[model samples]
Target chain A: MTSTIVTAAILAIGDELLSGRTKDKNIGHLADVLLLSGIDLKEVRIVADEQDAIVEALNALRKRYTYVFTSGGIGPTHDDITADAVSAAFGLTCEHDAEAMRLLAEMYKRREMEFTEARQRMARMPKGARHIANPVSTAPGFIVDNVYVMAGVPQVFQAMVDNILPELQKGSHLLTRSLPCPYGEGDIGTLLGAIQKAHPETSIGSYPKYDGQRFSTELVVRARDEAKLDAAANAISDMIRGLDAARAGSNPGPEA
Target chain B: MTSTIVTAAILAIGDELLSGRTKDKNIGHLADVLLLSGIDLKEVRIVADEQDAIVEALNALRKRYTYVFTSGGIGPTHDDITADAVSAAFGLTCEHDAEAMRLLAEMYKRREMEFTEARQRMARMPKGARHIANPVSTAPGFIVDNVYVMAGVPQVFQAMVDNILPELQKGSHLLTRSLPCPYGEGDIGTLLGAIQKAHPETSIGSYPKYDGQRFSTELVVRARDEAKLDAAANAISDMIRGLDAARAGSNPGPEA
Candidate 1:
């Protein structure tokens, strides 16, 4: 269990995110990636760009999870303070890194944009931090200790994460299967209860959706073992199909 | 400042949340509530329902933030182990609560449904925990020390929080105002930079939006001080309006 265990936490920093103006879709994306990789997503946090708040969150989450990924607050704007806050969390002073500056300088030269003082702020890094390569934007993300500080924008963050994921340690992947049922949870609740009782290793979830005219349910089966997951899903699917077939046979079709 | 400061971190639990299948909107909603009441949202975390994962996250977040609000995993399903994990975090025992049982019994009676063992499982609460009244659902959320455990469903979780918020301590409220400009961020970036320099107490954010054919910008002013927020917004608004007026005068009307 110890060898298979891996945990991760996400810290999203920005005022735009807190205001509900910018709906954070990245949390879900990262969570899925970590889950598939068998890294348990232990926690996620959203904080304002205030240094104190970000620092406090970083310190706490880093100590708990194996890895902490932070998004937002790493941009060129004055409000971008994730790097500074991360540095503060580790009790390190922030400085403009020569390597980071070189990367930004090259990016600016290629784009033909002035590398002004404001833009230069993007090159600042916490002491002893290594840059996470950002292909889309010139200003690379940095990794300090176990924390992976990446961009807020989805595309850039995804690219940065994709670049870094292969290098990190991974655990056995989580497995899952879903069976769609035309009936509501009420109709299949008893069968689900029996299925759950029999398969303690598998987790079964019932999700109900209403499409205005009709109601449908999606029963999902999940487990760490691929064979167990498939077996459990097949059993549940067979049970649901059996019930449907029995009802159809007894009723002998509405047209008849 | 210490006396006036109130902090909160949201812990979202369950595999469904980490997956893109379900977008966790509770973080944004809770952030707005916390901000409006002057309680700073320090962080938000999404974790799977594994015991150690949940325990580590709860323990870490509860210690760092003044208040920790957790959503999801407190249901009848097998994956719903937030209460158990939280209890483990505090080194407490989980037990069936008389108050919660009574509430569940009443709810079941009102709905004319049998209060089965599975439904009764929802009544289990960590020792010495106080119940957070839920008007929408009978499964009352619990508060143990600094941690508030709420439902995963958006409406139910919000209802539980609404009942709990009034009872909790609040900090100084954050105030914000938005001023829109017809030009893009690049056009008014210089003026916005000056506004930040002049009002160091306030944070100015510039957001650019492209509506297919044209580009527009919204400059937002935010601060803990209401007067400072309003003043900064007014100054930014004046500068933007002046730019628009200058453009109007220089270009003249289409007819002219």
Candidate 2:
């Protein structure tokens, strides 16, 4: 057994996000990236910039999952308290990082922007943390134990993740194959149940779609084992083809 | 002064969500609803279907936030373990409800779908739970204590929330005002600092937007008090207009 059990979780922190002022696109994008990298995304939580809430979520998620990624609330605003809450969760003190401050100072100097106390607020880091570089923004993200903290902005968060993903351990990639079936979910439920029983290791999903005129369904088969996945796909494809043939022989009804 | 403080948190469950197979959208929608209803969405967490992860998140978030909403893993599949996990969180047993079974049986009969053992799985509810009717889907959502368990599908989740939102208590709504300035964030940094100091109760945010022809910034002012929010907005707007007039006379250049 390859022990294909790599789990991860995401904690999104921000009042704006929870208030729906900013729609979070990072969760889905990160999920796809982590899945393709052979890591099972297990859970995601969105919390406001409250200290107690952040601390509770952090402690719970970090202990259960192999990796925990948090986004937002790392800005210079008064409500940007994710760093402090993260520190509290781990029982560590947040301090200004010399390297992060240097980076911020250098960037501000280059742009002729004032490095005010508010701007310097971005340089604070939880004690005993490693920095996750942000290419798009001067403010650097940090990693404490299994938790990876990044900015909430989609562009900045993605850039930081790109810099960090290559270094993490990945399990066997999950393989999926899907075939469109011109049948209703009711008609294919029995077949799907049988298929699921036949391939215990593989997971089968049925998605129904109605595009104006036709009622179509997509049967998806997924597995971590490449060979088993392919075999399951072939079996499903054959079953669908047989169903289509049988439907043709009968008096085909009007398009549903 | 009426002191109204409303808080909510979201708990997203399932291994598929963390593995990035499904992009969770219910959190954002719920966040919007809660905010509009004057409830501060305090926190959200995505955890696996594992008993420990779900139980820990529930206990922590429930104790900290006023209300907690959960989505996903409430289905007929073996991986659908939210009901069991929620029951464990409350130190209760998972039991089949006669009312829930009645609802499920009626739904199945209406759809002409078989009431199989798998379908019966939908009737399992956490001990001492109230039902949340799902207008879009047959499977009804449930509430235990302060935690509301909803479906994972976006459309269905929205419908379920719509049915439940009006019943929940709402606090006084927060007000927001914005003033657009034709200056960069760097230009208005000092002025924003002074504005923050002047109105300690408000949250002022500067967002930079780059159109093809020009660069401009928008200063958003937010507060729970309408009078304070209006006062801050007017002051910020006046300051930005002054800067605009001064710059036009001094530079006499095209907007960029």
Candidate 3:
């Protein structure tokens, strides 16, 4: 059975994220979740709340990727302008979505709170949009076309993602194996390239680290095929062992 | 005297970042540091360790911003294709620089380590590029045109930034004032929008938070002029206070 290749892009819109006032916890969290679902998150853009920037990035990402997920700029604040941007990107008029308005109004009434005009702004979305139910704050995020507008708040973002993920079509699972090698990238860079070339089905990456005292590398192998991934990983492990043995056998003096 | 405005963009490169194997710490850290230096960080792009992807992103960002800072994919590993991408972006030939080769050889010699061919790959850079010395590791990062290609390791990245920042031309500082409100964005979003319009010189943003028990908001005012920033901040403070008073004054029943 062949699996569908689903791809996604993230548009993290906020002035605070750009200004570094708020460190983005959403990008990493979503990246992890999307990968587990076999959806490849190809790229991510962090832009300010400017309508033009948001619209420009949104349109560019939406047309290319299977899905474009946006976080932040969906709050009740003046800076929360994702809805307007989404509408402008698709040339649709933004208005108060009827179902969203009704749901929010009922929520406010249940809490003994006034559904003020500002609160109504939370219900504003592009025409023909559907709501992504917000069980936390009651103001729902909206889905216009393939763009899933989500709240920037970490808790709300996670909840909305949890609510919406299962509805999407599935892709083949992406499996990975991590092997820690007691060697630097320099020790295995050449061989790793050869291994990657040999196992065309698997993707291999080498990451080097220096910890004050010594250097080490983490080699990660990824593939859709379980056998290919395992074989590549085993090859990498053997390569590291061979290199260690060779180094131990040779004791050449430093050529100053 | 008017201040010169400098803009910057960050291109964080790596597959591990996209796969969620490594959570990005460099983007936030660099954004924070760049803002304090009077540089307006406009956009950030996180892309996988692919050549065409890196080249496209680098070219796009380098042309638009005053400076484009790139992190990751600069290691000696086979997957570290950033240097090649950098070369391709500007059509420069990638080769081992004499200075970088000398530096790495000396460093390895001093440590009684072999400067193997694989280790020499660290010296590969675009022709005519200058080295950004790595204090933590012996391998050097390079600068080509306005793009600063730095190491992915957080410690090395920070050290390179610290070393490079002071030499660049300075711009007028961006100042900010933050005011906390004991209300949600819905309570003050409209009024905050009005305040933003009134203070055209300052950028005002309202961020709402839900702590599971209560709601609160943080209003931030930013401007190059300290006086303008504080003025906008005071206006927001007064508006929040007025909103609080109005809430306490009215005892409206829930309209079911």
Candidate 4:
């Protein structure tokens, strides 16, 4: 870990998610975006639309990580209480912001639609929070106490993330190198463990993929240092080749 | 909420998920299964492949909820440390079980494959844990304390869940009634709030969806009691009809 390592967590809030009615797309999208920004997405928590659950998760994640990004419950509805929960988390009252209300009202007015109180609810945010622009929808997300509250809709949530990511601090990009090993994980586990111990800084991940007939492992080495990453990848490749050679030497022909 | 309500939290352990390489399919599948079993899937957390991260999350979730279900990190690989993490969380040793070894040996012998030590890693589990059968794959998941550990592969995970769900305790099923209101949530929020107040037992969730031109709210009322659920659903329907009538009466015509 480096001194400038930026860590983040995502709090996906929705009852639909808890009920298994909605398969989450935001978590993966946000994870990719955060990784590109050199932010380590250390943890992710999904909770229901309940205020206490959201508030509790928000406070815990916000304290533990460098930044906490929340999706869902920022819509114009009664159950969309993300802003309120965020406000409650920080001991602040949620009130409609002048600027957010102005944007929403202007948009609704231009469209000849009712700027109903529920529509105005999207403008509500915790005190002392900065508004995050939502390019897809006019309603803005808000950032309070290192927590960036965004909409739950995939498109809207993605737009808000795109708008906010550039402003966040970045660290050294974590680079990765992968090698496809034609052997089962058991065949390479001990050697892989040794290699991982040798290269402590580079995080080694052995992912097993079993085909219909056999299993193969994909060894991925990730690190901030390019040199160390390359070294680890090369070492893993050599280990695989050595294993193959030994197997071939012992059994010259096809297995009986 | 009833005294017999069995709550659960899923700890999805995998670096691939955190890195955005694999979109999770296990959480939703497990959630649906738990719901059918009358288990409330209250929370879900995703963490990296690190043992400390997995152990910390496992400990927190296992203690907080009635059951903590985990998926991923239990495999024959260097980074598959879920078993070790579970053992550490409960202060138990992760050693290969005689029965698990016997099963694996028999399966491998039948398939005419090598029974390497790495392959034996799947047999390792926390001391005093009960094995959960995996119909798809022979590798068994284990239940330590209230934590049910399963594999990451979607098919295998689903199979393990099916094998385990019937044996766990069940609670009263939470049934839901959804009312699709064409009116925006703001138009019905106040009334919905009042209705929710009248029926405190039901959980009213207001989910808003935008169709480019207008926003509609999906008001979902969930409760264990069928009578209370029906009562709340009826109240919501009446409110929607009243709003539509009011809107038509005020506008008089459908022109701009």
Candidate 5:
């Protein structure tokens, strides 16, 4: 409910995602969660699990956004290098967290598995990071500065996010109203642009959807101000009505 | 075929996507298409519908990758500023192309609709750009320099990619083989890392999958050299067999 403009960026770290082997389920889910929580998702970058690439993208996003949420590259495998990259981005020492190690060790004991050296890799985090709980898996995700390093697995990432969202700062809710226009963008683009100019506070967008045979446009009006969003929606509705009436009147006659 | 290392990046532009109202389907589709076509997808960026942001991301990607493929923001609406932003990215003038105008006009004429100023907006392209045909809709996407501007609609974006991909330089085919390890990443990470170090020519990735109960890992080895790929795959297969044997022997009693 605060008018604060809290923004976020998602940095997906995995070669599998870039290879088309794994379609990213985390970005859209995070985007939806952030938007509903009143945080604006500004940019999303999908980089391979290369440390340099992860560090570069992470540094860039973390510097600009209120929060930089990263997924992948935090497992036990050698390819899991996100924590190291995030540490490098912040110029901090990455070492095993005593608490994380204890939690993971306890989880392994419960599962009747050895706490192998490789599994202990999951306990490593940047210095001074608060662990985000993973309800599904025992290994925890960590938040260092504004960067929240998360697992690539969809279920774990979602679970970690559910834990993280309640702790972050919320912004003004971005209100939106969608009106379906029977006509396509061609019929309403110019008028829509004018409405946008008239209501400068609103961000008006026309998205075209095709249903096999013909095209239709959906007019979405978004604004932080509810009054401005409503005004823009009304203008678009009026424009659509005018177009429909004109088309109806000309149905029986030839072009002028 | 050719062993040229062609790399590409995808720039998905839309506010709806960032807002989470629209789930993105183009990035992964493009990634799959690019990988199968022998072009390596190096990066994927999802940006909002701002012209400055588009230009910044487009320039950054186009300069680094062999090709930068963009989707969204090419429709007739005001929010469709990708064409102009791309033109700015390459420092070229955006104007109506004669051939594009003819094609769009003909499409409108055939549909018995007026070729309004809004619809005519679809014909504009950067100077010295070549049109990429959209089979779904007559309005063509365009390519300027190494940047391919495409539609946002999944059907149209895919059709445009079909037309543009064959014309680009194909890289060496990236061959891969997947071996499912019954053990999770914690069980095989150390050995997998050793295997990767032994075969520097191949890239090994261990992805963990959970089916609600237990976690299993999928080890994928990728290499351009077939012999090297097979050699690494065999090493991973041997490692998995060793782990399976050790587990089977231990199941009869307590840990050794």
Candidate 6:
């Protein structure tokens, strides 16, 4: 509904992720980066390293969102098939990229090691794709069309995100305001619903947290327009205050 | 293909997750639990609180995997519409269930709180769905067909997984053996590929780790059958030792 919102979907590829051997650190990191950049991370899909699964998820996500960011399976291993899978998804041929190969060759030369066939795998990408720099690791990630391919390692992925983010076109920033309501959701649910209905453009989310001693709800109102956000947040605050006053009148204590 | 492998997909529902306001704590926890239970978590999807998005993802995952687990948006708030989305997905009416209402009413009575319309929303479920107990909170998750809906709270989600795991019939345990290769993936990539080709049934995953000083690859072979696992693991060990011997003949150093 917000036309100015730039949407993205993340495709996390690796067998270790699905097998529970590796806990993914890239999704949240990318999510935070995208949020700050005014891009809406709309969906995330985690699939195994199988080429078909990766290709399927990649194509689907790329078609749905403004950008598709893929993490993992871009390393120097037999299971590092993200490049090939992504190429396949775009109907492009995978080949060793010149700049990527140059970077890897230089790094390997400095280490006095052979850039073997397996090591060279890190240089492969879909033809015509531009390379994204990786300061942490010598191997580079690539960007093709709307897809940005990055490494799976937390440090390398974060670096690539930083390097690529500046080149992206910015969109309208989504404004958000969080109000901590001491009352339970049950106590203020009706009033909150009325506020949401009144301000249909703003998305009001109620998240309840129980801290052993008491239950509290954090009401987050998000919208593209600042006016809508302010209206919804003010309405929510008034509802919370009304509930608090009623509770105090009955209980007549600070605990209320 | 491992026909005996029971596959599952997780659908994480919430606008908070998509907006990056909430770092998802449920996926990794569920993945670890499902892996230990002999169920392969094939895919995971994080979608917004919108009913259409939830229903679309839920239907897609339910039909694709042996089981589907959904977490979040099942609370007492206007935005908590997961039950309605799920019911719409299955063409089942969403209404208050007697057992769920009874459980929630008792809990509210114990706390001397009013079970308002919003609080009662937690008791709604699709027709013919059975309730899954929530010891952390009285509002129960539900299981309809192959879908298991659960809370988004980490503690509550984990408790539901523990409670429901024993009830489902488990498949053959996926056995895995990891061999720590001192050599990098590039050093053993070709040999590892040959070994993988020789053993078609076992899935060999190469995970490279850099521990500051050196880069090493951990070769993890997973299979349902024990014989296939042992065969693949032996082949991998032999390949690593062959690389080690070759390295020693060339360098003849303690590092080699």
Worst 10 residues of 3 chain B by lDDT: B247-256
| Candidate 1 backbone collisions, by pair | A43-B45, A43-B46, A44-B44, A44-B45, A44-B46, A45-B43, A45-B44, A45-B45, A46-B43, A46-B44
Cα displacement (angstroms), candidate 3, residue A161, comes to 0.3
Report residue B37 deviation for candidate 4 (angstroms).
1.8
| Positional deviation of residue B123's Cα in model 1 after best superposition, in angstroms | 1.6
Per-prediction TM-score, chain A only?
0.85, 0.90, 0.94, 0.95, 0.95, 0.93
Please give, for residues B148-220, the per-residue lDDT of candidate 4 as tens digits. 9999888788889888877789988988888888976656766787898899999998877777766677888
* Steric clash pairs (candidate 3): none
**Better model by lDDT: candidate 1 vs candidate 3:** 3
Candidates 4 and 6, the one with greater DockQ:
6
- For candidate 5, the share of real interface contacts preserved is 0.87
Give the CA lDDT, 0 to 100, for residue A69 in model 2.
95
Task: State in Å the error of residue A80, model 5.
Answer: 0.5
Candidate 5 per-residue lDDT over residues A113-227, each given as its tens digit: 9998889999999998999998898899999889998999998999999999888999989888999899989888888888989999889988899887889988888889888
Model 2, which residues run further than 4 Å from truth?
Answer: A1-5, A90-93, A179-221, A230-256, B110-112, B181-194, B205-218, B238-256
Interface RMSD of 2: 3.9
Candidate 6 lDDT tens digits, A52-169: 8898888778988899999988887777899999899999999999988888899989999988888898899999999999888678999999999998878788889999989987
- By TM-score, how accurate is candidate 2? 0.82
- lDDT, candidate 6, B1-256, per-residue tens: 4547688999999889887788888898888888788888899999988898888889888999999999998888899999999999999999999999999999989999999998999999998899899988878999999999999878888889988999876778899998888888777776787888899989999887766556777889998889989999999888877877887797787665
**Superposition error at A204 for model 5 (Å):** 0.8
At residue B33, what lDDT does model 5 achieve?
A: 89
lDDT of candidate model 1 versus the reference: 0.78
lDDT of 2 by residue, B1-256 (tens): 5758888878887655665555667777887788789887777777766778888888888998789888877766555678888898898889887898998888779877677675677778887799989766567889998889887767767888998898888988888887777875546666777887899988887654545433366678889898899888988887887777876786777762
Model 5 Cα lDDT, one tens digit per residue, B1-256: 3368999999999999899888888987888888888999999999999888899899889889999999999999999999899999999999999999999999889989899998999999898899999889899999998889999999999999889877999989999998888999999988888899999989999899988888899999999999999999999989987887787885755543
> Which candidate, 2 or 5, would have the higher TM-score against the true structure?
5
| Predicted candidate 1 versus true structure: per-residue lDDT over B1-256, tens digit per residue | 3237788888888777765567876787887788778887766667776798788778878988899999887766555678889889999999999989998898779878677776777888898899998776568899999999998778778889899988889887667788777865435655677789899988898654546444466678878887788889888878877877776887888764
Instruction: Tell me how each candidate scores on DockQ against the true complex.
Output: 0.26, 0.36, 0.70, 0.64, 0.80, 0.70
Evaluate candidate 6 and give its CAPRI docking class based on DockQ: medium
